[model samples]
Target: MTYHRITSIDDRYFKPFHQLLQTIFPPEEVLEYELWREPIQDPAIYVYAALDGEEVVGATEYRYYKELRVAMTDFTIIGKASMGIGRFLMRNREQHLEQIMKDSGTVSLGMFAEIYDPYRAGIHSFGGVSPMNPIVRREVLSHMGYKRLELTYVHPSWDHEGAAVSELDLCFLPQNEELSELPALLIVSFLTGYYEALPNKPEAWHAMIEQLKTKETVKLAPL
Candidate 1:
C-alpha cells in the first residue's frame, strides 16, 4: 500500500474517493460531489489518499486555520478493514500538517478533530455506517495522543429553527517545540473562543463554549 497527498480533486482520484466514502457512509451523510469538491479547492484544505496500487483504500481531510494555528481535521476514512491503514494515513497527514505549518510561519501547531458523538440520540446524533465504529476511531485517536477536551454542538445547516444540532466532541493534540507556550487546556480555550466570535448566532456559540468550559476535560493516556 502507498499513501499520497492529493493537491487537486481530479477525476482520477475523486471518482474512487467518492466511491470509498459512499461505501462507508450512508447516503444522508455523504456530501454531494460538488459540495465535497468545492472545499478541496481552497489552498488551506489538505487532502490525502491511501492507495493499494491504483485503488483508493483510505483518505483524510484537514483544514488549517492560520489565525488559530489549528489544523481542523474533518474526517479520516479507511475504505476496508485493515490493521494499519488508518494509522498510516494519520501519520502522513500529521507530517503534511507540520510541513504546511512550517511554510506558513505557524509554530505550535495544534491538531483538532470534531468527533460526532455516536452515543447521542436524536437529530443531534451522527448516525452512519462505516467499516470501523466511531468508538474504534476514538481509540485510534487516543493512541495517537489526542485529548478529549469538550463537548459542543453545531448546526449542520443554515436553518436555525428546524435544523438538528450535531453533538460534537472536540479533541486536541498539541504539537509544539515549546510545550509550555501552548498547553492542551489553552489550545481548547482558544478554539472555543474562536467559535464564540462567529458572526452567525455568536450568542449560541458563546453559550456552548461557556457550558463546555464548566466540564472537566478528559484525561489522556501517555502515547
Candidate 2:
C-alpha cells in the first residue's frame, strides 16, 4: 500500500530483483547482483529500485550509456498495481532515474521490453493491443529535447524473431527472496514492456523516457 525506493544498501530486496530476472530471463540478459547493487566504478552505470514498504517491487539496473552519452533503462521494474501501488512506485523510479541524469547531461535514456503500459496516459499513449502482458521501457533521451527521435526504437527485443518467455521465470532465481505483496509483474509493465503471450524471446521490448521542452512560445496568445 506504500511506495519505497530501493537503494544500493537495501540488500533484502535487491537480491530478489536479480534472482527474479535470472529465473525468468535468459542468463545473457541477467547481470550480476553485486555489480548492479554497488556504485558504478565505470562512472556511467547506475542501479536503482522502488519498494513497497521494505519489499523491492521495482528496479532499474543498467550501464549509463556514456560514450553514446545516454542511459538505458536496462531491466527490473517489477510490482503489482492490483492495489494501485504501481503508479506511485513509478513516480519514485522516474525521480531516481532523473537524479542520475545530472552527471551525463543527456536526457536520452534507452531500455528494452516487450509490451506497453496498459494504464499509460499523456504523450506516451499506445493504441495497439499487447499480446504479451505489456511491458514499458524508459530511455532518458527526450530531456535532451527530441520527442520523435526520442521514441524511434521503443520496443524490446534486439532480435524481433526470438521467442517469448515469462518474466517470472527470470525473477525466481534461487538467490532472490520473495517479498510479501510486491507485484513484480505490474511493475515490470511500466518499465520493460514484456508480456506472457510470447514465451521464448527471453526479452521482448524497450522504451525511452519522453518529455517536451515547453517554453513560453506565445506571449499574448492567452486571449
**Which candidate comes out best when scored by TM-score?**
1
lDDT of 2: 0.37
lDDT of 1 by residue, 57-153 (tens): 8888877777777777767887766547777887787787778778889874567776655676223212243435666666777676676653455
Candidate 1 Cα deviation (angstroms), residue 62: 1.0
lDDT string, candidate 2, 1-223, tens digits: 3443345545565676666555444443444565454443334445555556666555555544334433344454444434443344445545655676666566532332222223441232122212113333222221222122112223323233443322221211111222222232323333333323223343233222121122211111000
Clashing pairs in 1: none
Candidate 1's TM-score reads: 0.70
